[model samples]
Target: MRVRHSTNLTRNGLTDWIVQRVSAVILAAYTLFIMAFFMCSVDVTYASWTGLFSNLWVKVFTLLTVFSIVAHAWIGMWTVFTDYVKSTAVRAFLQIGLFVILFFYFFTAVLAVWAV
Candidate 1:
């Protein structure tokens, strides 16, 4: 038997499953992008770093990657807490705390990425 929580962002096991898988792919792609950039560049310098991010597409993709990371983390953490933290109050508190932290992380990432 599966337990369903009303406060879930996905609210369905299948949806959550799919989301985790998709987010993993997005994260993997982002990692590959960084790896490829390093491999193709002769020297990793400040200018090269800035130049890579200067592209609008790179900025957009970075934002998407950050968002994917937050979503993936939220779902993964929520699942763990819900499964092990049997107390409703404790689970709710943990989830809310994690949500706030993830939101802040994403917000900081956006500002750092775009300086906006």
Candidate 2:
């Protein structure tokens, strides 16, 4: 005989899987857009860079990229810790550290983007 798990738990995994895929797509698209922008530009200067980010649309897209990066990193790190780190104490510690770093990155990115 076999035991069955809760549907909610199953659904949660599926949700995470879907989110990872979506975030990856977003990150890739943003990377490509930035790469193309750089390649097309004849002069790459601090003024030009700042000007590119000055656009409202670019800022919005940059914000979305930040979100995608955070989500992707969280899911990837959580999966690794859960799968490989057998020690509960060690896993919890690592997860807490990851959360702190990711949050710090998020806030810092927001500040830098909006300060411009």
Residue range with the least summed lDDT across 10 consecutive positions in model 1? 1-10
Clashing pairs in 1: none
List TM-score per model, in order.
0.93, 0.88
Candidate 1 residue lDDT tens string, 13-32:
89988998998999999999
TM-score of 1: 0.93
Cα lDDT for residue 77, candidate 1? 93
lDDT of 1 at 3: 58
Per-residue C-alpha lDDT of model 2 across residues 33-76, encoded as one tens digit per residue: 99998999999999999999999999999989998898888877
Instruction: Report the backbone clash tally of model 1.
Output: 0
Weakest 10 consecutive residues of candidate 2 by summed lDDT: 1-10
Name the candidate that leads on lDDT: 1
